[model samples]
Target chain A: MNAPPMLEARGITRLLGEPPVQVQALKGVTLSLQPGELTLLMGPSGSGKTTLLSIFGCILAPTEGELKIAGKSTKGMTAEQLAELRRSSIGFIFQAYNLFPTLTAEENVMLALDVRRKAVTNPRQTAREALINVGLGHRLKSYPSKLSGGERQRVSIARSLIGDPSIILADEPTAALDGVNGKAVMELLSKISLDTSRSVFVVTHDSRILPFADRIVRIEDGNIVSDVRQKRA
Target chain B: MVYTLALRNFIHDRISLIVTLVGIVFSVVLMAIQIGLYYGSQQVITGMIDHSNAQLWITPIGAQSFDDSAFLKGGEKYAALSRPGVASATDVAVNIMAWKRADGGQQAVVLVGTDSDDKSLMAWNLIEGSVADMYKPNAVIADKAYLADLQVKGVGESGEVNGRKAVIVAITDHIRSFTTLPYLFTTLSRAREFMQLGPNQSGFVIVRVKPDASVAAVRADLQKNLRDVDVLTNEEFRDRSVHHWLFATGAGAALIAGAVLGLIVGVVVVAQTLYASTKDHLNEFATLRALGASAGYIHRVILVQAVLSAIIGYLIGMAEAFAVNWATRDTQLVMLITPGLALALFLITLTMCIFSAIAAIVKVTRIDPAMVFSR
Candidate 1:
């Protein structure tokens, strides 16, 4: 008997807009994530990959779906309950490196721990450690506006990892980076997934970082076209 | 952390935060000045009553207010004194008389006349000279606040009142009337001479109650004993005088309207500035929401920002108001900011800021965390 997946979605469908112009963003999409694996969700623009990621992050409710976190059914969870679940179990990284411009790198990372009301002996020290792990120790006192795009994204990645969450969701994490910085961020994500034994789900259309993924799922329109497992080189 | 974030955000956006603070400052100062003027006017209206040591006042029948009293026979003072519990009674002759300035220019003055020997009924505060100086023939006490309007130097300056040479023997502080008319305090006989009235004429009778006597009881006794005259406690006369000037004259309504207009302007400016600030930071707030921050947390952040603006702006505005008050200290329209008024205005500033933050709070509450994921 294998352990249940850390996160699972079954037959998820999302309809957006009003009656006369409703658009189905996701249709019966099914996905599962296990610990210690980096899963890449690849799709073109408007292909529902981001929509599925939003559902996995607990920010958007699926019209029809059965979602589970740590094998607990989220079938009828309220918005507040979903928010609590997200705070405790998931971490989100945006492509735009959505760090508060006013907050220093360490402060930005500390926000995740503060929001969850996690009892850490020293939040600043914990945030410092997280930033140092992401190679942002030297930039801990710098604000997002003072950092490069890669540094800002690393700060965000540090924020996502600070809580030691069960799952990490990254939406186009490397979309704003150049080839070198993009590769560095992808490798860092892969290493974090293996080192922390946390599931990493990344939504990206960039193919240059495909070698770092343990599994790849491709979506088109509103459905997943393929799912494949690959041996990391 | 919410406060910390709010402070950091405000400090980070220097230009916008300064603009918002400036708006708040303008509102606070406007309200303080307008409200200060209203209080100053009120003080002026009740100045004479407030300074007098009389426990009760006897005016002619049908007199509507202290300032509008009809002349009574000078013997009314003896009738008031004969009442039980009445310690002493003195005739007070109040009339509007023309004061001839040194340059021969005449100004209308509110002349207050009482027995010079009655020390208890003298001006409450004096800046120079003593009440004994008023015993001199044709001597008067003037308020320093009206020296410029009266065109006099100080104590010892000479002027003519109703064609009689009158010398300013003393100067008092803040003894102004609601009409902004100069006040002239002198002996009863001198005032009657200045107004060209008969020696037996008096406008009002001021009475003092014994130490062990109840003022209300003394007032009732005087009311029952005095015929064809209205006997009222000092407080009643003061309130009646204030009400007559504040309501019947339309000055109070105008002052209140100015204060209310200041409040409205402050609220609007604060609301607009705070709303614009929230709009500028909408994306960051959305990101916070996406990171599992509840609506309450974001609301607190914005409210903290507004409260900070209010506190700092209030300090600046109060400083400016004090400066204005100091500059206009010598003028008849004094700007008076009492401690109670200051505390009330502080609360008003806080309320104004919180009220202004509501629009921003609503905007932040409606922010969709899903937008963070959108392109």
Candidate 2:
């Protein structure tokens, strides 16, 4: 019972422009993501996967629909409320590895703690441990420019997990990596979700991530064409 | 925490930050030095007046217009001394003349004559030599700053004023007219002798007010008693002197206007540099917005960055101004800097940064997070 569903988006519809020339980015998205689940959103280009991901992450407001995070209705929520929810309940890993370039790997992880307004009694030690979890313990002082693609992605993952958010939203998190690094990142995400009972959602066109997910949600032209669940071994 | 992030961003922008700093530094330095010079000039004009400690100065109307040739008839002081509010009145003479040197050269000097035993005004403090010896024939006190100009390195050096032999008895601190002439203090008779005026001729009338005397009443009495003359307080005389010098031909005002124009140029350079830097990092800001930073956070970051750059620039500018002041300290360029001037510059630079930040904030706040999701 403790591993209950944590995030739910029901009948979400988001339009892009004004009436006559309106383009629907998300026709209707309905999905239940439970704790300890790894969901991969797979679709072709322009499938509205990124749009749906942004909405799930509490960043983009849907033109019309309902969203509930931890069973709380997201409707009528103020900007501050959304920011707090994003800080406490949702973690983000961008495809670009949008880490603050000025900060080192350790500091980047600490930024999450700082943003959440958490009192970091020992920032150095906490950051070291987070980097250690991502196998970047040795690169604590290395800046983002000095890190490799895989290392950078790992740092981004560490940043997301540092806040201990209930849900992790990764938008093509492994798209920038090669096969070996990409598979390693996917495995690390799967392990994190399983170990922490945190729901992980990956928006990607890369089919290689499908095997690592507990469920696969396929989208085509702004609509969820299919939802496939694969039993964990 | 947000400030830390904004500061880091500002540092990362090396070229733009440097450019902005250069602009701010130049503005601050110029503002401090130019304003300081104005203050120094004001002090120079009023320093002796303030130190004179006279309750009143009576002269002809537009007497300051003839400041270079101010002289009151010796008989006028007698009439002034008879006024009810007047405790004492003394005759003084002021004249601009050249002290001819033995080396076939001339030193520009302004002759000031005061009584050796004065109960009224104490014009220039004696830095060297005896004040009582000022009334001695051929004895005069020269401004300390003019020692080198007179080529008479020390006190007791003999010189000729208007072809009459004179000895430099005392050397006071730097006190000069707007024309930068060395002020030479002597007795009324000696000054009259040098200016070829009769013993009865005097330039200004110095009066001491009695303890219970009213200045306005005395001034009105003097104006009524004397025809075609002006009676002014020491402070009023100094103010008139400054106004005359500043607005006579509009040269000083024009120069100050030029400085103000330079400040505007600095503002424009800083504003444009900030705008370009913000534009270069537009997407980065959008990414931050998508990352759950509130619009207020984004605005604050931009303002913090701009202000940080402004402060760095201001400090650099002040440093440059100090260097300029040091280099030109011995010269007549008179580059000066003061705390109030620096404070004013800081406020100006802060305002410029705020203006620059407004543009950046507007740009960042309007950006939708959806832009980050695109490509």
TM-scores of the models, in the order given? 0.96, 0.91
Which digits, one per residue and each the tens of the lDDT, describe model 2 over residues B1-375? 568777888878788778888877777777767676676666666655666667677775677532447555556778888778898887777888888875869997888876556744443556777677676669988876678778798677888888889898777665655567777888877878888877666777777888898988898898889766678888788888777766675646865875686588677887788778778777767766665666777787788888887788888887887888888665544544677777887888888778867766777767776666666
Q: Report the Cα interface RMSD of each model, rounded to 1 decimal.
A: 1.1, 1.9
Score candidate 1 by DockQ.
0.70
Clashes by residue pair, model 2:
B25-B317, B60-B229, B60-B230, B61-B230, B70-B203, B71-B202, B71-B203, B72-B202, B72-B203
Name the best candidate (by TM-score).
Answer: 1
When summed lDDT is taken over every stretch of 10 residues in candidate 1 chain B, the lowest stretch is: B61-70
What are the per-residue Cα lDDT tens digits for candidate 2 across A117-208?
Answer: 66768876887899999899899999999999999999999988886888999989888999999999998999988955589999998887
Off by over 4 Å in 1: A195-197, B62-65, B196-200
The sequence of per-residue lDDT tens digits that candidate 1 reaches over residues B51-94 is 67778888888676656736885578888777889899888888
Error of 2 at B369 (Å): 2.9
For residue B294, model 1's alpha carbon misses the true position, in angstroms, by 1.3
lDDT at B349 for candidate 1? 89
Candidate 1's displacement at residue B277, Å, is: 1.2
